[model samples]
Target: MTKPSRTYRSELRTEQAAATRRRILEAAGACFAESGYGRTTQAAIAARAGVSVESVKAQGPKRDLLLAAFEQAFTGQEGRQPLAEQDQLAAAFAIENDDAFLDTGLEFMAAANRRAYALWRALTSAADSDAEIAPVLDGILARRRKDIESAVGLIQRRGLLAAGVRVRRRVAAELSFLLSPEGYQQLVAESGRSHREYLDWIRSMVRATLERMEP
Candidate 1:
């Protein structure tokens, strides 16, 4: 059946908006990655995008900053699938890349981890005493959940997730650690493994777990 005209236009508009948002996000990501969340201000992010501070604020409120980034980072896999729908097992199997599915999957996963970790560290630290920062922290976490849920849907469709494990709970934990700058930095500071090596270990372990539960 042919799709509706309005649907197409709506998609086009969304694509445009997303593109603009992505430009801003990529810039913000670089800043956050380098400066840590506490150090990077919205003005710096706007400068990276060559836009004004007000434009950045208008583009999205500070609370929505990470949300915008998370939305852009993942390819919209709203990967949640009910366990009962074993028929759509294909959803769980991600990354049809020639470069080893696990490797590619973890590459994106690490990217997501870095972004989320920055948000988490900033929000959590801010929320320690300031009540105003509470909502911003919640907003960041809410977006992360949405993205992970999308990933979970893909896993359910492909049945690639480990069996017998609580899907939502497991995804949440994996995402939490995978994109955790704090955890990554801690491991780096204490364990002496380079970032590249640490990510490899992470990717391998996550994939192995999937193989055990779903393969």
Candidate 2:
């Protein structure tokens, strides 16, 4: 049998590193969800990931791990990317029809909220006492607000917004509140609503709000 080339070996190493990083992030997320951020340590994450403590440390500190885990949860991926950079949102915005836009946009938001809701709860609960987490929380909120505003801007530009809803600020705020993780937790997690039911409810609410404001 022929041996693999150096390039192939290098690619293999890169893939292995990525896999390890993903495992560490997954373990950290589980630890945070179960124990809360205050109680979750690097050592705990290391053990949960079945890697050495030094391996976890090489990834970064606990704060970095928390941020990475949250990113993975929200994006359903390992690497960090801005919300505005998401191709799904861009595709949704490109959809000219209001119904299509709302459907696709709500679908994306609901999926992300479903994946991240538990970790979001853990982070919010921990942020109350952990000052280190406040910055990450703030950054996430700011990005969410920006994304809401961007979506609203697209709708307004398409002349799909309701006539009475002239204020972008108010519309953005309402959408943000409706699409928040807390709302998801309440409806889907606590109220026993299926993911499909929750998404349909959001779609209905968004359509009604937009129709009522349609100029």
Candidate 3:
């Protein structure tokens, strides 16, 4: 029997490494979400992932792990890329119908909230007292605002934005405030609203904002 080529072996190792890294990040996210960042430990994450503590530490320190896990949960990747540029939103961005685009955008927001809100709540609490985590939280919020602006720009380009919506920055800020993870945490996680009810609230608030801007 012929042996596998060196190049094939190398590729297999790379895929395995990527899979291991993803597993560790996922475990870290779950730990942070359930235990909070101050309480979560590398050992705990390793136990959750069924890997060694050293392997978890090999990914990064706890702060890096929290940020990476949050990013991965939020954007489906551990990077600083804007949401407008992410591949996950490509199909939604390509929708030419304004109604369809709005629907897709809301669904995307709902899905993202479902995936990341718990971790986001953990991150928010960590930022309150952890000096190392505060800046990271600021950066995440900044990126979120920029993403809202980008979405507004896209809507304007498609001629879907209302004529009365003259101040885009203000509009973006309103959207950011309205769609904050804190609100999601309160309404869905703490207040015991079902996911569908939370989504309906989002749709109502967003539509009300848009309606107010209609000329």
Residue 96 in model 3: shift from native, Å? 1.2
Per-candidate TM-score against the hidden true structure: 0.53, 0.88, 0.93
Backbone N/Cα/C clashes per model: 22, 4, 0
Steric clash count of candidate 3: 0
Local accuracy of candidate 2 as per-residue lDDT tens digits, 1-215: 99999999999999999999999999999898788888899999999999999999999988778878988988778664566577787788778777787788889899999988889988888778778888778887888887787778778878787423446667888899888999999999999999999999998887777676665
TM-score top scorer: 3
Tens-place lDDT digits, model 3, residues 103-142: 7788778877888999998888988988999987888888
Model 3 compared with the native: what TM-score? 0.93
State residue 93's C-alpha deviation in candidate 1, in Å.
1.5
Model 3 gets an lDDT of 0.85
* Model 3: lowest-lDDT 10 consecutive positions: 159-168
Error of 2 at 101 (Å): 2.2
